[model samples]
Target: MFQHSRLTEFLLGLFAATSILAPSAAHALGGDGDKVVARVVTFGGACEKCDLSGRRMSGAQILGANFSGAALVGSDMRSVRVLGANFSGADLSRADLTDSEMIGSNFSNANLSNARLRGVQARGVAFSSAIMVKADLRDTEAQGANFSRADLSSAQFNDTSLQGAVLSRVDGRGASFRDAALQGANLSSGRFDRAIFVDASMDGAVLNGGQFDGADFRDASLHRAALFGADLSGARNLDQDQINHACSDASTRLPKGLVPRTCRGVTPHWSPKAPPAPPAPPAPPRP
Candidate 1:
């Protein structure tokens, strides 16, 4: 009878110890730095306008967290998973988001100026009307993401894949897009003055009614792209054949030696098409 009582007491002590250590272990995941750890990252707590500046948030899971109007300047968010998190109107200037997964994340009207989004996989993310001036999006895959009306002046998009992205009416003055793929993207009515498109592929993209004054398209491919009513006056590095292959309208202003009749005869369509066959395999080499 005495032994049974002792065993019960020991079990009670062990339970008490485990309960005491569990909360500490959970809290340790949020970092014990100088920044306030009012909320844990794993469980996710509401901290709107939270001062998360200079915090080390690498590989942290902050799903559905409300960080609207939060100050996240210079934060290291590399490889972090922030699925469905709300960052509307948040200040993320100079933040490093390399390889981060922000699927379906909301960055609407947020200030992401000078942020580094290299290698980020942000499929279906919404960045509508966000301020992303001078941001670097090198090698980022943000397919079907929305950036409509966003201010992307002086941004760099080297080797980025923005297939089917919504970039309608975006202000992209002086932006550089080296070898970037924007297939089937919506670029309607946007301002792209002085933008560089070196070796970029924008096949089947809709650029209707956009302002492309002085934009450079050196070695860029626009096969089957719809430029209906787009203003390409004074656009550099473009040839007659490149404008002929694309669909434009009477309102589309072309460079010198390239007539508007090439694109003005037909309506613009935004769909991929197979290349022409090689003359029936050259008649089977004449047998």
Candidate 2:
């Protein structure tokens, strides 16, 4: 009888200990199976190759974080501030970063397919060679950002600011830049076939050797834009007045009855005007 009583006491003690330790363990090592569901608010320092797939990290501040090659697929990262972070080679497919601020971040070679980047402020971000197919970048301000050699097929850039951004050698087929600002942006050697540039400002933009076959340029401002050796034979809504505003060469293919002017020693009709500044980003989250 005494032995039975002792066993019951031991079992109760064990249960009490487990109850106390379980919460701490779960808090310290938060995960369900192979996936980790972190409840961290501010993310800093390095977490290279971390798997943060499907996590809800909205309004999180990622300051100077190195999340290179991390898996952030389908993550909810809306209103997140990613300052000076290294996200190179990261898988961010289908991630929602709407209204986020990503200043001076490097996303080179990252997979951003179908990502929602609406109203994002991405100044000076490097997205070279990134796969951004069908990404929604509407109303984004990506000035001076490098998107060189990136695949932006069918992506949306409506009302976006890409002023002075480098997009050389990009495959932007069927992409829409309606009412977007592309002043002084480098689109040289890029394939933008079937893309829409309706009402977009392309002043001083470099489109040399680019392919714009079947692309729409209706009412797009091309003042001082360079189109040397560009293929726009099948372009739609390209008026002679627009052609006169742009600097083109004999090698520039145009629609029927449209002639291109030589670029040598010809002065621009109007001075370059800068686009309106983007809205101020939200303040960073407190520590």
Candidate 3:
């Protein structure tokens, strides 16, 4: 009888312990079986060519890290702070980076196609030569960022702020910049056929030698914008008043009956304001 009682007590204790530890173990392993949880919270140092595809790294801090050529496709990296990180040549396609802060980061030649970057703060970041086709960048603040020669075809930049941004030679065919702030941004020598710029503020923007065939410019402000050598003959919704506000030269191809004016002493209508503060960092995960 005593032996049986002892055996029963041991089994009961074992069951209790297992029940207590099971939940914690599952939580540590990321309760969901579909997503792989990241082992570390903070990422730094060089992790070049690392494959981190489909990892759940929301709110991660990746300061000064070198993740060049890494694969981060389909990762959930929302609200991540990646200051000064080098992500050049990385494949971040279909990744969710909404409300993230990536100031001064280098993403040159990276593949960010179909990525979600809404509300991202990317001041001074370099996205030159990156393939961003069909990427969603609505409400993004990218002042002074370099996007020169990027493939931004069919991308969404509605209500985005690209003040002083370098977008020279970008392939922006079928891209939308509706209500965007592109003051002093450089779109020189780029292809923007069928692109939408409705109600956009493009004051002082340089569009020299760019293609704007079939592009929409309805209610867009072009105060002091440079249109020298730009092809706007096939553009839609461009009125005489808007043309008078812009600086155009003889090389600028405009719609019939619109005269080109020189850019001398033109007063800009839009005033520049300081960018808004970045969003707060995400809270730490539960222990």
* Top candidate (TM-score): 3
For candidate 1, lDDT tens digit of each residue in 24-45? 5646745433122222234233
**What TM-score fits each model?**
0.77, 0.80, 0.81
Q: How accurate is candidate 1 locally (lDDT)?
A: 0.75
1-287 per-residue lDDT for model 3 (tens digits): 12333423433343344335555675786663222233234545555676768766676677666778888999888888887778999999999999999986889999999999999998778999999999999999888888999999999999999988889999999999999999989999999999999999999898999999999999999989999999999999999899998999899999888888887875353343443443333333233
Whole-model lDDT values for every prediction = 0.75, 0.82, 0.83
Error of 1 at 127 (Å): 0.9
TM value for model 1: 0.77
List, residue by residue over 1-287, the lDDT tens digit for candidate 2.
Answer: 12333423433343344335555564676533111222234445556676777766676677776778888999878888788778999999999999999887889999999999999989778999999999999999898889999999999999999988889999999999999999889999999999999999999898999999989999999988999999999999999999998999789999999999776675343222332333333343343
Model 2, CA-based lDDT: 0.82
For model 3 the TM-score comes to: 0.81
How many collisions between residues are there in candidate 1? 0
Q: After superposition, how far is residue 144 of candidate 1 from its true place, in Å?
A: 0.6
Q: After superposition, how far is residue 275 of candidate 2 from its true place, in Å?
A: 16
Residue 136 of model 2, lDDT score:
100
